[model samples]
Target: MQAAEWRESIRNKKILVLGLAKTGVSVVKHLQALGAIVTVNDFKPLDENKEAQSLIDENNARVVAGSHPVSLLDEDFAFMVKNPGIPYTNPMVVRALEIGLPVYTDVELADKMTDATIIGITGSNGKTTTTSLVGEMLSHASNLEGQSFVGGNIGIPSLDIASQASEADRLILELSSFQLMGASEFKPHIAAITNIYGAHLDYHGSMEEYISAKWRITANQTSEDYLILNADQKSVFGERQTNATIVPFSSTSQQIDGAWYDQATEKFMWHEEVVLDRRDLLLPGNHNVENMLVTMAVGKLLGVSNEDIKAGLAQFHGVKHRLQFVAEIDGRRFYNDSKATNNDATITALDSFMGPNDRVVWLAGGLDRGNTIDELGAHMDKVHAMVLSGESAEKFQALGQAKGITAIAKAEWIEDAVQKALDLSNEGDIILLSPASASWDQYPNFENRGDRYIKAIEALANPDSL
Candidate 1:
């Protein structure tokens, strides 16, 4: 639908905005501006909902903030706009579904409100780095300068940028499984899945449900659209069924058609043409090389020159909290991979920096999401010591003991974990904070956990400063 038509359809319609999170606020503001009769609902009490109260005052919209009253559902509402974080099991959402009212996320609303070409990216890992790279590559391309907007799960909400985009613009979005779950008509012109692994099973309930949510990225895509995937990931390639043109990228195999990392030559190749040397990339690790391949494939499809792609990949560093270098103290290097919220992600982090003589003082453990750490057993030989914390610390200690890791210590907090890792590390050793679980047991999110880790490291480096 065109932007004007979407605006016309929402004028004066009774729309219910569920949850007053960041995305929820954006939805209420956008709908109100379009002449929709908006009613906001959130579980937080009115005294604690300053944002919702402000929105009500500014937009003149009705709000039921104290609780999710079922009486609100009795009103003849046209449809519901749900926050991505609000689960499908929410009582109000369940009621809305039973009544046959259409439920949507801000992502779907953004899709209907814009005519720009969309590039949707989703995966268990590497979504942020790939999304940021795509944004930078498009920015450097002389043809695409001032014509690309990158946002979604990476930070800025897509709904806030959709109205400002023109038909010639490119919307680069990093979509999460939660946002994708409520998406019905969000068909991106170019969609890609970095890779899928067992993650968010606590919310998704099963591995099958988690995989299905990721596949929704290409559900509405047609043959004219493009779907970039990791050819090395059997779970992604073997299970994918889509009408979109499949563009496979790999760091392991060269038999694929779209893009491949030629390990023999250490070059990134697209259709047998070498685009850039592996040594030129600023980002480290084989996983990052795979991310570059995905970005290069998208650039190639958009007619971006090989030179431009090489330049973008060379200049781009990486996103924070994913194998980020903290600081070197007393000959020991500290790296933060706090974004490793699952076993698969931690495995990738471990693979990134393990050598014959190197020793890693690994810090891990958090909200156990029911995924096993058996995969890390094969790589345990590289670890010098294990420092565990959070709710799953004891479980991790037992797992380490079973793998024959001799030096293991358990801490009650992240600060203590950092100190424990420091005590166990020797000169020339590496201390890595790659928690293979969620941080909800302590910090609100992974970013907060990573920031706390950085702060603790700084304090440890200067003991007398405090």
Candidate 2:
């Protein structure tokens, strides 16, 4: 029986959830009803996550909330559901794998639990925008089961409900290299890579390691499967062999196949066949153009009609925290780009930094993962001034000032960073929070960082201050 069936069964079972993150909480909620006793563990202290406290209390499950202990897995339950964020080398998880207990992510659970035809999207950047676009493009994608869930990596474990999904329709998954690295017996019928760039070197420990993980999207496909590749990715643009039929998309060059950029009109040429006005895309930046092409190709391959694709793209709103606009505060616009955790993403954030009056007070820096900033150097002049924070703050400040790009270093906090950006920003200036590093130093993750930035900006905007 699948998770849904097991939950309703009278037989009690033991299951260990290896992380108490957001997805873990959702999985716990569902498993509790299935008569499975779940023990939730994490690297943070038991009381660290206040939001999770109420959940732990309600679920009545044992909590090993700080630093996963190998002892927790001591010959434990039938299986373990690993969170995507956890690394492969984790000692506790490694021990579980050695014991021959099945270990998998919420994605694998979702895949096994549901009969939905999965369309998995992964790449170094642009995944969130592309995933949301594809999900919006074909809301009608439904499995014979008559239901579908669209999520993964971008937040929400869409696969958690797979076992009980009625429609189990088409699933549009936003996959990450980290998530793909640990997967086994997991394959998407339709897979796409928006583009790949230097990112997550710390986790993978090398660009080669990173690229190897990205390629897993198409590793297990059969000839009937569809593989969408971004022709613009120099690392993976050319010379590819896969069992799946290949579909390519790009915004930089026009060549042989699936999707190409029409430089003249700034629109996407589908199948190198039809053109859609680029300006009509709701998302901004050259990066987004590349992402939309992937979505268009996948959408059409999945049997979505041209009209349905148009409807989805036209109605699609960009994902939150990826250049999400809050509002104008004190004549300065605020943007929450906490999703721009690495240099490649921040470059995309900066690409969209050009303001109406050529003014941008950039808020950059965080737990620098060691990805080089040589690429962003060319856009220095576009940033009028930078308000820096986090461990990488000083380094970026030095780089900015050295390049003669006006810069300032501030205490490592979003409030201080926002205030400093505002102090230096003039009317028509954009108060941008596009930190180029991970937010783990002061926040749980990017979402927490994005939330704090939004809250701080709101408080400051309405302050009765001096």
Candidate 3:
């Protein structure tokens, strides 16, 4: 169906929007504009929810704040729009599903509203960085100017850009497992799973369920579409089944038909064609090399020139809050990797600085997402000292002790953790904030947590007395 027909179908339909997060608010506005009777339910009280208050004041729809009353599900609602963060275990959601009401996220709505060529990217680690690099590479492609829209889980609601996109445009989305769980018909022309590791188990309830959710990105794809896989990650390609054309990219395996790094010549090869040399990439880490390989493969499929691909890789510095350089003090380098909200991500960050001279004064810990810190034990030797913070601090400290890591300290807050890391660091040490947990314990999100870490570093650089 076309956009207009889809919009007309929802007219006068009763749509219950659960949660008042950014995506939920966008859904409310979009549905209201489509002439639907929108009712919003959020756990936050009206006084605490600015989004709810604004909608209530505007009289756009009925707003129920402070609680997700089960009675709301009793209403004659046609379907429900859910915020990704609201798990299926929520009483209202569970009841809604029990009653046969279809659930949808903003991603599904975006897909229904546009005919754009969507390129969906997802994984445990590297989603943001790979998505950002794909966007940059496409932006530099002369043929794709004014024809690429980038957003989704990377901080922008896809619905915000879906309406503006045309059939000629390409929508690049950074999809999360939560968003994918509620998606049904949201298929991309090109879908890429950067690499999967155990993550979001608290919300997903199990590793199998988490992997299943990640695989949903390709559920709607067909043979005409392309599904990118990580050949280096054996688990990623082991048991996965997809109808879409599988394009495997690897940092180690040169035998792959898709993109692969040729270690012998220090070049990136795309099916026997040399795309670019490794030395041209500005981003650090082998994980980043894997990301670039995926980006280059996607670019090649889109007919992007080798020159544009090389230029884009050279120009892109990496995403904020993902191993971003904050500042240097007394020859000690600090990096903000607040986006490392899982053990796998923190492990990747730890591996990034594993050289003989690279000693990391690691700052980690945050909201425990029901995952053990034991996986991080393998990388603890790289860390000279660990200054932990937030709800998982004590747990991480215990894990560090078990791993035989000396100089472990726990701080009440991120600022104190930064100071503690600074105190333990010597010249040439790397201070990294790669929390292997979520940020809900002390901040709204990872970006806010990273901003606070950056601010704390700035304050230390120019003390009040100075």
lDDT tens digits, residue span 1-466, model 1: 6877988998999999999878888889888888999999988988898888898778777888888887799999999999888889999999999999999988888888888999999999789999999998888787564489998888888888887898888899999999998578889999999988888988888878888898899999999999998888865445558999999998888557889988888899998788999878656578788789899999999999988898888877567898877787999888889998988778887887665567899999999777777888776677869999888888888888987887999888888999999899999888999999999998899999999899999998888988
Structure candidate 3, residue pairs in collision: none
lDDT of 3 at 347: 87
In candidate 3, how many Å is residue 43 off? Answer: 2.9
lDDT of 3 by residue, 1-466 (tens): 9877898999999999999788888788878888999999999989888999999888557999998899888889989989999998999989988999999988989988888889999998789889999999998898674678899999888888887898889899999999998577888899999998888999999988998899999999999999998887766545778899999998888567999998778799999899999768656678888899889999999999999999888788678888887777999988988998998788888998876688998998889777778878888777879998888888989987887778998888888888999999999899999998999999999989999898899999989843
What is the number of residue pairs that collide in model 2? 10
What local lDDT score does residue 417 receive in model 2, on the 0 to 100 scale?
79
| TM-scores for every candidate against the unseen true structure | 0.78, 0.71, 0.77
lDDT against true structure, model 1: 0.87
How do the residues 1-466 of candidate 2 rate in per-residue lDDT, one tens digit apiece? 5444544552366788877667877777667765677777777776677645866677677777768778777744888888777887888789988899888777776666566688899987779888888877777434223544578887767556454555346777888987788677677899988777788888898877788787877877999999988666655544556798888777778554787778776667775566477666545566677778888888667666666777778666577888877767778878788888877677777777553445778888888777676677777567778888888887888778877875565766888877888888899777778888888887899999898898888788777642
Highest lDDT: which candidate? Answer: 3
The 10-residue segment with the lowest total lDDT in model 3: 231-240
Model 2 stretches with alpha carbons more than 4 Å out: 1-11, 43-56, 64-76, 140-148, 160-164, 234-241, 325-347, 353-466
Where's the lowest-lDDT run of ten residues in candidate 2? Answer: 140-149
Candidates ranked by TM-score: 1, 3, 2
| Residue-level lDDT for 100 in candidate 2 | 91
